[model samples]
Target: MLNVVALMGRLVADPELRHTPQGLSVTTFTIAVDRSYARPGEQRQADFIDIVCWRGTADFVCKYFQKGSMIAIDGSIQTRTYQDKNGNNRKAFEIVANNVHFAGAKNANGNTGGGYANAQPEYTREAPPAAAPSFAIGNNDDFSVIDDEGEDLPF
Candidate 1:
């Protein structure tokens, strides 16, 4: 069977690292993923999804990601059965993250600040002059041509 999932969204809350009894690190958090479509007169909708990260991935997320930060996750869907305090059985579904990444541009401290929704391109400069270059391509005296005998051909 094949199971894979990829999601990019803003975190609903900061990830808090925890340790299992076996001393393995873990963290659970939710992200708000916007739906692809909406009714013609309605506002866009978003779904809150639960995500689980383990070990190094958990620690990394807790250290670098926070509430409102955009995150990209690659993982598989997982479901579990458990009993809540009321004694009713329930099923929970979440993404078990295999990889997590920063989804926004880095700020001054080399940390991603605003979410991807407001991220700016990494490189920005003034636009080039509208007119074409003054130099003529074939008439340039700086150009040179070489005759190849094929003996030194790389291919």
Candidate 2:
């Protein structure tokens, strides 16, 4: 049976990372996904989904992502039941995320303690410098010494 699910949405809050009793890493967060269609004269609606990640995935998520950061998750749906504080039974549904990927830019106010702006590249700490190759020939005339015989060409 197939139980795969995929979703792309913005994080509703920062991922909370913790350790299980066995010392395994775990993280939990919520994603806010907008509805595909909007009713006339009505605002678009969003669904808040709970997600859980384990091991290295959990560490990576908590370190890089923040609230309002767009992300894509691939996982399976899970449901569980427990007793609430008031002695009432409660049921919860969540996604057990196997993979998580950054999806889009964050809003201006979404920046948490991280100093970088949303427009900054998420993977790089600094912009790459632009420079001309040291071996580059300035003009086509520089290659005039080449021969068509497929023999060794001088640089």
The candidate maximizing lDDT is: 1
What's the true lDDT of residue 74 in model 2?
A: 100
Residue-level lDDT for 66 in candidate 1: 91
Estimated TM-score for each candidate: 0.71, 0.68
Per-candidate Cα lDDT values, in order, are 0.88, 0.85
lDDT of 2 at 87: 92
* Poorest stretch of ten by lDDT in candidate 1: 111-120
Model 2, stretches more than 4 Å misplaced? 105-155
Candidate 1 positional error at 97, Å = 0.1
